[model samples]
Structures are given as C-alpha cells and as structure tokens.
Target: MNLSVSLASGEPIYQQIKEQIKRQILSGELREGELLPSIRHLAADLNISVITTKRAYDELEQEGLVASVAGKGTFVTEKNKEAIREVKLRQLEEQVRSLAAESRMLGLSKQDVIGLFDLFFGEGRH
Candidate 1:
C-alpha cells in the first residue's frame, strides 16, 4: 500500500492517515479482504508514531471498512457494500452542495445549474 502523510497539512497526522485510507478503500484501490500493512510497519514507513497508525486503523474498523484478526494482520472488510454506497452518496452530496453554492454566486438559475450537472455527468458516462 502506498501512503503518505504531510506534516505541514492542517489536519492531524492520524486524521490524514484515516481519510486517505478511507479514500483508498472507497475508491476500490484497496480490494476487499486485502491485507493491510502491520501497524508497526506502516508507522515505520510513514515515519510517524505507531499510535497514530493504530488510531487510524481503529477508526477504520469502527467504520466497518476493515477488520482485525487474532494473530493475523488487519484486512479490508468484505462487508463494505452498504458502507461503500453510503460513502459515495455522501461524496456526491458534498460535490453537489459546493456546485450549487458556486452556481448561485454566478447568478445561474436552477434549471441552468441542473443542466450543467447533466452535461458533466452525461460526459462521465462515456
């Protein structure tokens, strides 16, 4: 797994790790049942504290996106079907909300804004 954490980022290291891992899982970059790096390994790779990596993994397990097994390492959960759908929907909602605010500031009508959405989404199907 490729992971990076920016010390200069405004977000905390644990949060950055958590969000990036979540994004990777949601984007299908990390397959279901895929084994994650050991917490110590990941911490060494990122040059961060083991507790930070553990915190991120803890959050992922709580979100049902991953699971920890006895003696074995952490693995991406196979039960993410509904969780994935919800995550994608929330992402779409945030995108639409930002676009709506931008469109309003640009003095676009509702129909015009929706048409723009159709244009964007329609092209994405190709």
Candidate 2:
C-alpha cells in the first residue's frame, strides 16, 4: 500500500499512517490477505521510528482491519461489508459537520452548500 506522512498536518505520524492504510483497505486498494510492509522496512522507508509503525499496525489490528501472522508480516483482513459501510458513513458525516460549521462561519446557507456540492459532484459527470 502507498503511504505518506505530513509533519505539518498536525496529526500524529502513526495516526496518519493508520488512516491511509484503513482507507486503502476500505476502498479495496489493499486486498484481503495482501501482506503489508514489514514494520522496520516501512519505518525505514518513511524515515520514522519502527515503534510508530508498530503502533499504527496495532491500532489496525484492534480495529479488525489487519492480522499479524507471528513469523510473517501483517495482512489485510476480510471485512464485514456493513461495518466498512458504517465506517465510511461516519467519515462522511464528520466531513459534513465540518463543512456545515465552515459554511456558517462564512454566512452561507444550506441551499448555498447544496448548490456548491451539486456543482462539484456533477463536474465530472457532464
């Protein structure tokens, strides 16, 4: 899986790693049973500590998104479709909440938000 970290993003490095990996799994970019990079190797590649990568993988395991095979590396797990859907829905809800707050700060109405959304959502359709 492709991953990157941004020190300026204000999120912890492990969280950035965990979230990208989760998104890849949820979107099927990382398939079930695909082996993730070894912790040390990934850490070296990202120029971060192995401990950070291990923590990210641990969080993923706790979320049931990946499994460790002892001697082997971590791999993606077969997910429950409903659970993935719920996760995505929650993410969308959070994005909408942020958008709503930002729009209110800019004095934009609900209709204004909908109009902007429609404009962007339809940009590629046409």
lDDT of each: 0.91, 0.94
Q: Please, what are the lDDT tens digits per residue for candidate 2 over residues 1-126? A: 689999999999999999999999998999999999999999999999999999999999998899999999899988878878888899999999999999999999999999999889977674
Candidate 2 residue pairs in backbone clash? none
**Residue 31 C-alpha lDDT in model 2:** 94
> Candidate 2, 88: how far from true, in Å?
0.4
All candidates: CA RMSD (Å): 1.5, 2.5
Model 1 CA deviation exceeding 4 Å by range: 124-126
Candidate 2 off by > 4 Å: 111-126
- Kindly list the per-residue Cα lDDT of model 1 for residues 33-122, writing each as its tens digit: 999999999999999999999999999999899999978999999965887898789989999899889989999999998788688777
TM-scores for all predictions? 0.91, 0.83
Give the best candidate by lDDT.
Answer: 2
Worst 10 residues of 2 by lDDT: 117-126
